[model samples]
Target: MEDYYVHPTSIVDAGASIGRGTKIWHFCHIQSGAKIGDGCSFGQNINVANNVVIGNGVKVQNNVSLYEGVELEDYVFCGPSMVFTNDLTPRARYPKGHMGYKKTLVRHDATIGANATVVCGHTLGEFCTIAAGAVVTKDVLPHALMAGVPARQIGWVCKCGQVLDKNLHCPDCGTQYLFVDEKAGICKCGGGE
Candidate 1:
């Protein structure tokens, strides 16, 4: 028996692989060669393009598309209407096809907020938070809290999604983090270990 649930209006192509207990909701289209991991939830009007890989426990909200060359790691959250580009430059007349697509990787436990636009070729680091309406054009650091157009790292965040203080401690969760450098850090209290 099939392990996943696809809404009646959704179409999961024959070669697509959906893991156990995943739920694909209304108007979703999962193209051939897509691999979706266990317990993922995809909301309405979503598209999973060929070869897109979505990991376990991910949550993709309405109107999002996982295009070719985009990968979501485990427990990532994609908010409603978020955009992900696969090409740096796109022309209707001169299509680059799949060969020209650039990869955008959202690492484990990251959260991309509503209406956010993630340009191709960037990696959103683990536990990073992209605030609503932000435009991400470059790589994000782990635990960074990014906001604004052409997103900048305004602060750090905890694995539990709380903004961290300057001392790298989460007030909401009381988890401590240690900075390895200006751009990298790790949780000291085993929150994201």
Candidate 2:
């Protein structure tokens, strides 16, 4: 595609779908059946497995691997060395193939920091931030900031990647957010002001 940039050292399979203005850097491998949207960037040594879905304006840093059954919404950021797994119980010699795939969703504008591990079957809410080296095993709420082992929410964040103040407002972007508790035991945000 004329709008995309793929380094000569990168290997993109024949069946892979790359969108407009996407940039794939050195040593990256995008497998067949992977769908990458417009204005995305995949840094060095990144690997995107088949059946993976990456949305528009996503920024994936170096050394990341997005496994099968993972879907990233628009404007998502995946930091360096971040890993995503579709299998809950991965064995060294298991051969279930794609039948064992478990879906993982990263919502719009979310940021997953460097060296983080995201287990499958969980949805990261919109505008959420997962700090570096965190292991995410459960669903993250909207605008939440999660860190540490097992990924606990230490505070709330805004879509602009700023931690929210006491008034639920982001000073960096002057964006306001609302937290609502639903019957599903999840907190939802109404987006920026």
Candidate 3:
């Protein structure tokens, strides 16, 4: 029951769990059974459905809806107006409840840009970046930069949010990645040099 901020205009259900320092802004609705971690921010018009779990330091921008079966790991960034689909097939006549909803996982430090659409049943790897307006149809590899329709891996990115150079180094933050194996993939260097 640590202190948190929920705007007067927002409605947080009785059984929802909000961690310390989290803020739910105007017009947001947090349903019962939702778990939000510390220092997270949910902007205006957001919806946190029942059974949803959001990890610490996550920043969810305006107009985002987190449906059931969706899990966001720590330090995840959900941009403005992004869409998350829980059901792949929809028939208004045939309704699929929470039991039918597909699970979606956004790993730690991932950035899903504004207006992006993440289809259900996919895992967005840690530190992956999904570009604005792109539609993610499959699992994204860690540190990969995805763009275009159906989202292809255009290049690799650094944890600092910069596209990695030819040497697999971050130009902005000085983070370096050492190529371990072509199959096993690159690993982040221990300390910034």
Candidate 4:
């Protein structure tokens, strides 16, 4: 038997690599050249496009599409119906293939909320949280709590997925953080304990 589990209704194309202990649920399609790491779980109606790299322990909710040129690091969470756009400017008449696709990177331990739309060619730093229904049009710093259209940083977040207080401390985990710059911060509690 294969290491991973693909549901009877799901389609895993030849040449797609699904790591050990991964589970692909019903109606999911994993295209050729897609690399899904170990211990990942993909919900129903999900599409993983060619050349996409998804790291270990990633959780992709239902109706999500991971397009080409999108890379999700380990422990990333993609909420239900979250959208990823690979083309900066898409047109039906003019088709830009791989060359025209822009890369979108979501770093480790990030959470992309439900219905969030992430425009390509930007990087979401580690431990960042994109709020539900947000439109992310730019790079998001590490540990940032992003929300609203165009996804502005409303505040910082702890690695435990809790919003940090003004003192840069997490109420839930009691983790401490220090400002690195205007757009970024570092977890003082041993790398976001």
Worst 10 residues of 1 by lDDT: 184-193
Candidate 2 residue-wise lDDT, 1-193, digit = tens: 2678999999999999999999999999999999999999988999999989999999999999998999999999999899998988878787668898899999999999999999999999998899999999999988788999999988888766888887777788777665665323234245545
* Pairs of residues at least 3 apart in sequence or in different chains that clash in candidate 1: none
Shift of residue 147 alpha carbon in model 4, Å: 0.4
Most TM-score-accurate candidate: 4
lDDT for residue 17 in candidate 4, whole number 0-100: 95
Q: What is the per-residue lDDT of model 4 for residues 1-193, given as tens digits with 9 covering 90 to 100? A: 7999999999999999999999999999999999999999999999999999999999999999999999999999999999999998899999988999999999999999999999999999999999999999999999999999988989998888999899898898777888877755665654334
Instruction: Record all residue pairs in model 3 with backbone atoms less than 3 Å apart, i.e. clashing.
Output: none
Rank all candidate structures by their TM-score, best first, as comma-separated numbers. 4, 1, 3, 2
Determine which window of 10 residues in candidate 3 has minimal summed lDDT.
182-191
- What lDDT does model 1 reach? 0.94
Q: Where does candidate 3 stray beyond 4 Å?
A: 180-184, 190-193
lDDT for position 180 in model 1: 82
Q: Is candidate 3 or candidate 4 better by TM-score?
A: 4
lDDT of 2 at 71: 99
In the range 36-68, model 3's lDDT, one tens digit per residue, is: 999999999999999999999999999999999
lDDT of each: 0.94, 0.89, 0.93, 0.94
Give the C-alpha lDDT of model 4. 0.94
Q: C-alpha displacement of 26 in model 1, angstroms?
A: 0.6
**TM-scores across all candidates?**
0.96, 0.91, 0.95, 0.97
